[model samples]
Target: MKNYIVASWILFIIGISLLTSCEKDPWKFDTDRKPGLYFVELADTNEISFDQLNDSTWTRKLFICYLIGVPVDYERQIEFAPIDSASNMKFGEEYKFSDAILKAGEVYCNVYLWAKRPAVEDEDGKRYCTFRIVENEHFVPYMYSTAFFQVRVNHPREPKWWDAEIFGAWSEKAFQVYMRYYNKQEVENTDNWQKYYSTVYGKNMYIMNDATWEGVPALFLPLLKEDVLVPVFDYFVANPSDGVDIPEWYYEWKKN
Candidate 1:
């Protein structure tokens, strides 16, 4: 009888251990703690053709912020716009590439901005604005302009462990920890590495001509070699509109 009780207790303990080990981490899918998104528009006239107002030539920048709960804490973020389109041009207003190439008259383009939600706010909000094109006296649209695009913000995925590790690092010790465990398997190429790293690191590292790892032995290099950087090269080759290049170091590193 005593042996039976002992065996049952052992089984119970084993069951409990298995159950505890199998318990899903509550934080894994909890996006409730994510940051919020802030969107803004910036104008550029560098591409504008002075002679051809109707020509699609103006440039613009759209900024998206990923803040940590606090809206004010939002930092430098991604920018997106269209390419090679003609629309009305205003002397001082911002215009996206999509806005630049509308029909000579009035037209519309739906603009979107994506970001994370504040940790406390269950529901986020979206802001809508308009873009207008006014023709010059010649009845020919000479200037392309946009008041500002409607900035519809949406909550993106919360930062994963690796994201936090890479972007949160402020010291050598912290950086090394990021370099050691963050999975590089998903980062198939240099462009992928750049996008992933920038999303997590909060800055553009792949574009950095002189980026280097500090605080660790020189032998423990975390830099991607050129051959291994093929993915990034192929990405740029495929998507020239992205306006970024795969650095020469990546190609050099790949040859080895």
Candidate 2:
């Protein structure tokens, strides 16, 4: 009888374990029990710069991303419009967006900002607008309701990692080259490396009690290489822009 009780208890425990293991992951699913989406990198206001473009009619893009659910097999249109009262942007004079579409088999889509060079630049070289994603056949709103985009004639602020002795003086060309490889937002790239470090690329090297990251990260920690550095020099040589001079040391790198 004691052996029979032990066998029954074992069977009960095994049955419970099997049931628990087969249950769906609670954290992996959407909060609404349905598909949903949100704006990427727009927890707060972000800028769309015309600093790199020379054309009178220039363009940039904002991403409309999925916060939940997997990528679908077909395309879906994300419908949005400018909030008239909140937006200061003059539609034709300053900015307008192209089709907002989540492409086939993708989690996000582009809202193209087609910018026009205003006859007069906005005060402080910036114009602001807000857009909201509405209820659609594809997705329901998840967390963020609205996103802000600024049209700005932003000037490049040199990053702290830039060594003047090695790379020469920081210029627009070098900044653009760094951005192309560094793959970060413009404001984060220009700010102090310490502040940028806090969020991106966790510095958890030690195994013991030393886990919290503090006081600046290494300059281009995993990104510094000959391939990246070569482009900066190549850009200056290729786009010398009339009167500007190229630094003497950079004449060696053959464009690859």
Candidate 3:
């Protein structure tokens, strides 16, 4: 009879433990907490040439969501509206997101903005577009953000005289050294060629004006400083096929 009573007590304790275990802490959405997605803005603005648009698609992480310690398992739709009414790009025509649904277990997703190349020209032959992410049922737009992203797509600028012959093919180490030597600013032309005048120390600089050298596409200079002579830029232009070893001039610049 005592054993029976002890067994009953054990069973009762087991039952009480089961009831306590079954009870769970309540979970409520923190209404006071401001949690939502935001534009990562990894790059405030992105620009790509038409050649880069070969695939007719470009991607930008226009939005990132905060992990609110809960999974947003529901299918949510995001709204993309243009701030510029007069912009040339048309929604559902020029560009679109490959997928609009924010899938489950995803903290962030990328908006793949795509557009077709049109055979047309407006003075510059470039198309400009701007977009902003809007709020939806699942999340709200992040505060303290411009909430806007800009895209500029255009054709690649024409190759300059020097670029046509030896832009990347040649080692421009000496030219780079010269820039550092003078502490000069590199001015870019419409053709995107780095152009600037020689420094006072480099007054005898050899300029490459014409396109051809030795009957080949060469770096030619219109102005050659006959009196002053810094043969660094000239030597590389003359010997495009040779490697650019560190010259004594570069060492001199370092000493100062």
- Against the reference, the lDDT scores of all candidates come to 0.34, 0.59, 0.45
What is the TM-score of candidate 3?
Answer: 0.38
TM-score of each: 0.21, 0.45, 0.38
For lDDT, the strongest prediction is 2
lDDT of 3: 0.45
lDDT order, best first, reads: 2, 3, 1
Q: Write the per-residue lDDT of candidate 1 for residues 68-105, one digit (tens) a residue.
A: 23222222222233322432222224333322222222
1-256: candidate 3 lDDT, tens digit per residue: 9999999999999999888766632464665553466555533354423342232444343344343334566656655566565356676676555575566767666556665554445324356556666666566666432333344444432223333222233334433433343332233221112332442112212333333334322122222111111344455456553555433443453356
lDDT of 2 by residue, 91-206 (tens): 65667778877787777666676765543457243567777778787777768757777666655565555555445666765555555544433334445234443244322211
Q: Give the best candidate by TM-score.
A: 2
Question: On lDDT, who's better, 1 or 3?
Answer: 3
Backbone clashes (count) for model 3? 8
lDDT of 1 at 28: 50
**Model 2: pairs clashing at backbone N, Cα or C within 3 Å:** none
Arranged by TM-score with the best first, the candidates are 2, 3, 1
